[model samples]
Target: MIREPDGSIKIYVRDNRHPQVIERQLRNLDVRADVTFLPPGKDCREPRGTYLPDNPALLTSEPPAEGKDDYWRLHPEQIKPGQTFVYTMWYEEHGDNRMFTARYRVATGPVAPCEVVPGGPVMKEGPEGGIGD
Candidate 1:
């Protein structure tokens, strides 16, 4: 974790394991976070808690550059009290390629445990599809 001059925190996560440890570390930094690392092809049910609306200004990410690591920039000053940040990550494999996915959510109340379930299917629309179809 790197503290920026703008008072924001940048966190680079290279591993999806040990979510509990990550949560503890964030708590030590006065950042309430609930972290969960799901298994491949599994996901948590929606409405895990009373989530806040999406705020890109408060939280944003940048892909890795030539010599930099991928990181999420979090402006804690924008976060209100009693709010908890939720982070979920997983990995997907397609043939010989592997992809990492992560999601961020802010909740005002207690967060629910990650009840693992199968992920939904990926939908693809073609040019033949109609607006009412």
Candidate 2:
């Protein structure tokens, strides 16, 4: 996730394997968003829900939405390995006090339906209670 100067959030999820579908589950206020699928062999640094460095991900010229909305659903048929999916939306931060969190599950294989990967440990809070690795 990349936090903007105006306090918005952009999320990037890369596909290291095959094509897949995803649902953006967000709460609070509605948001405007753009979704994209990057080709394979491309390089994108995961934001880890924080800052945006000098080198951001290479995306298509036209992002899906230039306005705000509540959510977006993506289903890419051929996200080929190494490709990436991106979502840029509002973060809706409260007055100096907001808690942000994230959890993801992935499944991919040659079967008719993908299997769910077991859940892992929850993220531990940082010393300062800020989002960090």
Model 1: per-residue Cα lDDT over 52-97, one tens digit each = 9988787877777788755777787766789998988875445434
lDDT for position 114 in model 2: 18
Candidate 1 positional error at 62, Å? 2.3
Q: Which residue pairs show backbone clashes in model 2?
A: 1-49, 31-68, 31-69, 32-67, 32-68, 32-69
lDDT of 2 by residue, 1-133 (tens): 3334544344333321122222232122122122322322222233323322322222222243655422223333223333333342212123443322222212122212212233322233367755332
Candidate 2 overall lDDT versus native: 0.29
Task: Report RMSD for candidate 1.
Answer: 6.1
* Model 1 stretches with alpha carbons more than 4 Å out: 63-65, 92-98, 120-133
lDDT of prediction 1:
0.73
- What's the residue-level lDDT of 79 in candidate 1? 65
